[model samples]
Target chain A: MIGVELRLMLRRRRVWLCWVLLCAIPALVAVLLAVTNLAPAPGQGGAFLSAVTSDGQLFPAAALALVLPVFLPITVALVSGDAVAGEASTGMLRYLLVRPVGRLRLLTAKLVSVGAFVLLAVVFVTITSYIVGVLLFGFGADAAVGGAGGITSLSGVVLTPLQLAGRTAATVGYLALCMLAIGAIGLFFSTLTDSPLAAALGVLAFVVVSAILLPLDAAAGIRFYLPTTHWLAWIDLFRDPILWRAVREGVFVQLGYIVVAFGAAWANFATKDVTS
Target chain B: MAGQRFSRRWLLVAAGAAAIVGVSAVQLPAAALDVDAEALRRCIRAEVPPYVGYAEASGRLGLPEIPQLESVTTLLTTTTRIRSYVAGADRWRADQLTGALGDSERDTYHLGAAEYVWDFGGNQLTRVLGQAPLRLPRAGDLLPPDLARRMLGLAPGDPVTAIPARRIAGRDAAGIRLVPTDPDTTVGRVDIWADPTTALPLRVEIAARTGPTLLVSELLEVTDGPPDPAVLRPVVPPGAGAVTASAADLSGALRDLRAPPAPARLAGRARLTLPSTPGSDLPGVGVYGTGLAGFVLIPTGRDVADRAVDGATAAGGTAIPVPFGRAARIGTPLLSVAVRSTGRRGSLLIGTVAADVLQQALLELPARGRPS
Candidate 1:
């Protein structure tokens, strides 16, 4: 299954190139950020500008702004949106179906590869950003707990550079989970169409709809529980005393969506004839 | 057994004292309107109009106040000079404001100062720089013990305290209040005047022992968002050619100049009054007296310039007090300001402390001559 997935990916150079670009863009951005401090000087009103601009926004608009609209969704759509369609369009999927491998196993392998690619893409972006951030921002005791206790930690806390990297790794894990739902939806749609562009576009269209709906005056109640809303769960990484409730909910919701998406794909692909 | 009994007795005594102190807090006279330091800090940020200190030249509004633009730029400046070891050649000019000190590369830093510019909206530093007729946030009655006491009975050299109340500026205020006092005292009682709708002060009447100095400051302009960065730059203007760096000059820290404005005089019969309330549409009832010569009651939307014009319109061999004092000036003054946060207990006084840096830089200014 791994050999087949590799062959399939290599056959289409554009997909390979996209994976490269996805990693490269963030790395380049990280480099630029490392070279210069984007924040203004201490006294010249820079701090206020940084603080006041935040809203009840679900994501740190800065990181997500760079990631979601451009990288994550684009990558997801390219891979998941083209899964079944690309195979059908190139006429290579049939030869495999006639082989000994079961249909379920075939879908599982492609999905795993898609999952691997998503994790790889997110990890690269995370590491690149971290390196750049550390270089430019320096490890200046990131926070000074100026309360009456005079900055002692109640629990064990880590301060070494290596520890920071570990902490950041956990944060990236949370972010990757948030994007999983987007990739799931794309995977579901990949089975719905024969044209890769149509499928890819369909995935983006789904994201755009949610993005628009999230802000309208009516997105309360059950509507707030939409898939993309969970996509913004990454901001939980920054809050002190991390709100585990929100993180737990986010994880479960994406898991729920993944189950439902694959369930639908299985039901549809299992029964429908693929003669065309 | 005897030692244990003694220790227990002492612990009980300490506990009793703690209880008594707790009871005193509940019984304090100001308990009804009493706000903790944190609540007061929140109020201050919420109520006070964010202030931005700006002073720059060229391609922007210079420190020079415009004739009458219906706005103002609250600005302050600070400067610093540092000398470091040179690597190969001493190429860095001493006059230029450059160099990172933390790394310690022997790069000398000179004229390293920053300006805080609050445009129309009146930011604590940046947030409200654009919206005009600003109704500053109420820093609340959460002043520290000394400041609260000083604010209540403000005197000359005492800091002034202000809060936003509904009465002053109609509807423009979130709740606006302003007070002015010397460095010695934090603001005590502040008279707030703002049109809630316009958020502009109709009058800001400050009561102090030195006589109530009323600021009839008008929101002449509110250029929303940040002022132009170039306007915030401290560099010399075009054709203001840069001077060469001096190696032998350790006089970098020496004061460059001092030019506090000469006290302006009012005509002997001139009068300035600050009516307590119902003082017209002004933000407060604060008034300014020019050495007791004459008094003019300053109302909101009425600049001293407007008052001067009004005095002229009255057609009299009369006198009007100069607005905003005599407009103080100092030539290339060097300052050393220390900002101690009054915002939170330990959260650096982000907004209020900006003033300290500016104040310190001006304190140890250089004399009249350029240098020895």
Candidate 2:
């Protein structure tokens, strides 16, 4: 069933569109910066993006930062929001329920498909940006900017290319899990309603509201538990020593979100009446 | 007989107790001396930094702030003279007295958010109405106790011992010295001379690991009289050309010849912190390292850096290879400056720190032409 769902997701033009959009941003930025004379302000952006104006090898990292804040999550939310709600709205869920496939198994397969889309979207962004950035900015020696691990680590050293690659993969994986947690929330909301658009908007609204509250000093104490709080923790991967405390905490928080969200989705679908 | 034997043992015990008491009595004065030393340390700690002295001077000398001094001071090892005059907090004037036959002195001034340069021989005073005024370095900052504490990287509980008193310019002063606690730090030691009465630092000497004093600032003369108010104002000669530096101006005229614009962790090892300065100097001075091993990156326009480098090379300075570009080691062991150019701008990496540390800074600092 998971394989079938994955095949269906891969066959969708919407999923491919999201990937194309994600990949285009980095390439566009790379080309624009190459032709233009725009320079990033002093001490702006992460170590990698800051390096983009100097070396093109960092363009992919810069592009990832640009998309991570909004685009990637939006793509994840759209895919997950449509999972159960889209089928139910089209009157297909009632027919699928008649088959031998259990409601819980169906929910799992939908989640896996959404999770696969999240992975594909992120990988597309990273790989596309890397190729475009290198083509435009010419690969140079690994220039470590600040501190041991560069931007995030307490150590003031730059990581080797192999180490950087490993950290980047880990960061991308963590980002994927974070997106999966968001997708699970969207799936849970999808079970609540038959409108796919409404489910997607519900997930986006939570993210937007959390982002708004995160900046208020008064909400600082409780803000740590918000789903959006650790969205940028992947930046620590760029640090030379790879600061683990925040990144580790981020992973745990995402896992907690996934557990609650997936559990709610399972309970809802199990008991939900499929009359549509 | 039993009673007599017991009485004798008691007597021996009383004798031992009395001996112990007598020894403690002899050590009482030593304990008192320790108390005095602690008091001295506390007083020195409170009075040494200019922050405290500034307050004391404000109360004692019926003045708004210390009068800005514009006087020519000769470098310790070289024939070059630097004329520095600071006014109205941020307004500054610095003139390099180049002893050339036909070349007049070059002066850089920052007046009311405007930075400009005056070439006496050329009869031109070019002003930068650029995005911001370039921050210039000051001589007074080198002698502050706060900077000394940071340079030495001292913890509150760090051991700071007293050096013998010295008579500096006729003022009797005691010196407090801090040695680097971290073995990895390149700094050897820092000595701050404080007036015993006022607790203000009279002189400061920073030394390297090899025991050569890297920099020293001492009062050559003393005067409590208020400075003439007339000299406090900068006088620009008539008919000098005025030039405005635009925001995008990357010309040698208005490069951000200041330190790093923001706090940066350099070469992924140490954080470069901006040293706190009074209103007189602009707030862009960057000092890297909390330990002995650190360098100061003074941003100068490419012209200034090139001139200095050329001047040093002409005087038989050695060229040192760096990752970005070649740097020059001007002067001997007594005084030297390593000049490196980056981002089309030039930075002078000045310190007694090891050459490798300077090289690391040169390799990692952002290129000078804007962010790109």
Candidate 3:
């Protein structure tokens, strides 16, 4: 069942298009940076994208940072939002239920497939960005020299290539897990409505609202509970002697959202009559 | 029908989010107003002594200190090699000390606008009227007296708080912390120690945002009486030729000595005031965010662009080639200089900001000032 669901997600042209869009963005950024040789001013674009001119090895990490806030989350929403809702809307839910498949088992398979798609999407962008960045700007030492020759790490020690690669991998893995909470939210919305469009919009609305309020000092207290608050916490992985406090909090927050949202989805789908 | 159910949940989420924001709004302003910069400034100002008695001091200005008997100049920091040794308010002397090998010294005397400079280094002495000469802070002023005055004179937006009292210069003093309100400022904070009796600053330290004490000036010892009157007089050796500089020549030479136009906003946080006119012997005064952070751009009259490039080459610092010209970091801490010149006239953009910020400001100024 998981294999069939995974194959279904892969065969979709829109899913493939999302991958293409993700890969093309980093290449475009690299080309633009190479041609212009001017970095974006502070607080512009991805946090570390400007660092690419000085060191290309930060490219993959920067690419993920650029897209994670919006593009990557939206892609996850599209697939996960359609998981159960698209089936119900098209009258396929009733047939699947008639084949002795428990609704619980069906949801589990669908979630596993969606999760697989999320992982694949992230890995594709990372590999493509690394290759394109290395070609445009030669990979140098992992020593993060800021501006002229200032050391930026908290410990003031540069990381080796293997250590940098390991940190980057850890960042990618953490970001993938972070998206699962959004996927769960989409899946919950998918169960609440039969229209896949409505489900996707629901997830997008939650994300957009969270982002809008993130900067406001008034929202600071309760910000820790919001999923958006933790999206960028993955940057801590690159820190020397990596800061685990925020990263750990982010994981627990996302895990809590996944549990509550997936539980709600299961509760609703188990009893809903598949009239479509 | 299903849309209606989801709409109800959406409204609930929105309300919860709004409630969180509402609660945060009520609490944050109270937290932010915790420090009052104005009160802190007044307290420090009240403590500065009106007079700093006979004092002797020695400290490192950056890494190198050229030790001298009567007075020591840390190579004067800038390329011009301008040095000043002042005893008190009415009597002070500044010398345009040049030559790499103790080659020459042009000593200038400042006495109530009657200016006399004996250029023994260039073999000429010049007299000028109505030209207010630039005055470097005298060693007497470098004590608790002048540094406290500058701290008190800072623009008002910086938050100032009173910390614990501590002993400085053998005197018990209260400490005041000044934090730049502008997020973009390179000054992390400034700590000033003021005499409990005189309310004058006894010690001042300027630190960068990245946590390093960049500049510190303190009096090692101070007496209760004035110095010998002879110490205040300027003595010129014989054989120096005398010349006269016209009023017009003085004005023209100092024309580019005006202050940099005020930036609308610095580092996007501090709003700036209109720049004041150039001071006699002083360059331009540019203040940001009510004086939390500011810099004086003193015209060097030399090609600052070339100087920056040369300095960078020697200092092992990278020279960022900009459209206007080149910018470079010449030294570290107390002696650090950011050179920005258009070759015609160059001004050293010196302040408490990090090296890169100085470079950015110099690079962006020319483009920002003129309209296409």
- Best DockQ goes to which candidate? 1
Q: Rate the local accuracy (lDDT) of all candidates.
A: 0.37, 0.58, 0.61
What does the interface RMSD come to for each candidate?
Answer: 25.8, 29.7, 22.4
Docking class of 1: incorrect
Candidate 3 chain A weakest ten by summed lDDT: A147-156
Model 1 Cα lDDT, one tens digit per residue, B1-372: 655644554455455545534542333221122223333333333342321111111011122231221122121111111111111111111111111211011111212222121111111221111111212211111111112222333333323233434322112333233334333222223443333332323333333323433222222122223333322232321111233322212111111112121112211122234232221222211122322111221112224333333422343212212222211221111111111111111000011112233233222222221111
* All DockQ scores: 0.03, 0.00, 0.01
Residue A188 Cα positional deviation in candidate 3, in Å, after optimal superposition: 0.3
Per-residue CA lDDT of candidate 3, range B1-372, in tens? 666655665555456545544543443111112224355467555543234232223333342221110132332232232333444444555444333322234455656657666543344556765544423333434444556667556635556777666665456666778776765456677787666544556667766666466556665344434434543344332222457774334543234534444344443334344333334333343333335445434444444346545755575665667566555654454434566556455545555445666666566555423311
Lowest lDDT 10-residue stretch of candidate 3 chain B: B63-72
Candidate 1 chain A worst ten-residue window by lDDT: A147-156
The local lDDT score (0 to 100) that residue A238 gets in candidate 1 is 32
Better of 1 and 3 by DockQ: 1
Candidate 1 error regions (>4 Å)? A6-12, A30-65, A135-138, A141-163, B1-372
Docking class of 3: incorrect
Q: Which one is best on TM-score?
A: 3
**Ignoring the other chain, what TM-score does chain B have in each prediction?**
0.23, 0.49, 0.56
Question: Is 1 or 3 the stronger prediction by lDDT?
Answer: 3
